[model samples]
Target: MYKKILLIMLCFLAAMACSSPSNPDNTNNGDIVNGGGSGNGGGSGNTGDGGSTGDGGNTDIPWTEIAPPLPVLDEEAIKYGIDISQEDSVIKEQIRTKIQQYNKDKGGYKVIFIGTPKSEYTQQSSLAKLVIDIAEELYKYKKYKYRNRY
Candidate 1:
């Protein structure tokens, strides 16, 4: 009975092997045509005539310019209602003083302060999560001011 079962299993294995497509490398002709002559026959590999832009080709859509993030004020600046863009020297001194005060008060939780040109600021890590919050707040303030003006 064991021999009979083994023989039946062997026959089934032989039938399966024979019934399957013989050429492992050669895909079906319909698949080849549909796949752009590749084995899987999918045309996903083709990105026809798109201009190369080093990293990837320039996509079809136009790119929009994003504005730089707003800087966060230390507690004193926030308390005093100081605008960040008031004269350059005064702003610099105020920012420096604020950093020094923050360092003194926080006790070794060092905040890496930065002053950057608008373009560079947009590209830097110094304006990460905190900058996003400040930008949203500043946007609300600007909107409020605009509404009050007109």
Candidate 2:
């Protein structure tokens, strides 16, 4: 068993020695001997600046991200919650805030609401569609807000 192990070790060493280049630079004295007929003989051909992966930098083109389309709160969604008819951004924000609060009180999940009291969404004829639209808006808003996050 000992002799067998020694023989295996010797064989592995021999294989490694045979695989390695005798002169990695293909050089002798101070000069390289390339097979090219040119007398300027140097084994190396010009290697580039150390093999860049190119994802991080080293380019002219600048990276830019196109902003996604803004979420549109439909007329029905605005209509269901309150009577604010102003065409102002502040009112829009207030409407969204109200919707979110109502959603939270009604056991909201992601953006959908459930188990709500009748008082909150009393307009039964338009309530379901309004809730769906509001939920969709909320979903889009959440995604946009957390765009950079995992």
Candidate 3:
């Protein structure tokens, strides 16, 4: 029974693998026309997986233009329009204070703070890496915004 199922799946995959959409140039990976005299086929076969972009097409958030992180709940809620979550409240308070100080020094600017905790980050788990994935996903959906642009 397992052999039969495996065979079926293999066949299905093979069929799918063999099948490809014709490019806008009227070419596909499949077949070639054999005209007359001992003909060898012409035209390049598209061996690519439909030139799959997959998830790589997502635009990165323009972080350089981000507003300062709103230090308090009211500002975070109002500016980001979402409830903020921090795994550690003591650190959250510290982060708020840091943001406030930074904003104060810079004479205040809008910055999007991805609500992930910075304290939890290791060298391998930097905020940039975390923010990038989330920001890309958000940008793909047109949900991420740059305050300066507005």
Q: Choose the strongest candidate by TM-score.
A: 1
Lowest summed lDDT across 10 adjacent residues in model 1 is found at: 47-56
How much does candidate 3 score in TM-score?
0.21
Question: Residue by residue across 1-150, what tens digits does model 3's lDDT show?
Answer: 999999999999999877855454543333322211122233332322322333222224344444454455665544443223443433344344444454565656333454533334554445444444444554555443464457
Q: Can you give the TM-score per candidate against the true fold?
A: 0.24, 0.23, 0.21
| lDDT of each residue in 1-150, candidate 2, tens digit only | 999999999999999999987766543333322222234345232222111423222233333332224533664444334533332343345546777775666665322222222323234324455546656898898898899585
lDDT of 1 at 1: 100
Q: Which stretches of candidate 2 lie over 4 Å from their true place?
A: 1-95, 102-125
Question: Could you tell me the lDDT of residue 53 within candidate 1?
Answer: 37
List residue ranges in candidate 1 displaced over 4 A: 1-64, 67-87, 109-150
Q: Higher lDDT: candidate 2 or 3?
A: 2
Cα shift from native, residue 1, model 3 (Å): 82
Best by lDDT: 2
Each prediction's whole-model lDDT (CA): 0.47, 0.47, 0.45
Residue 90, model 3: lDDT of 39
Q: Flag regions of model 3 displaced more than 4 Å.
A: 1-111, 114-118, 140-150
Pairwise TM-score winner, candidates 1 and 3 = 1
Q: Which run of 10 residues does model 2 get worst, by summed lDDT? A: 44-53
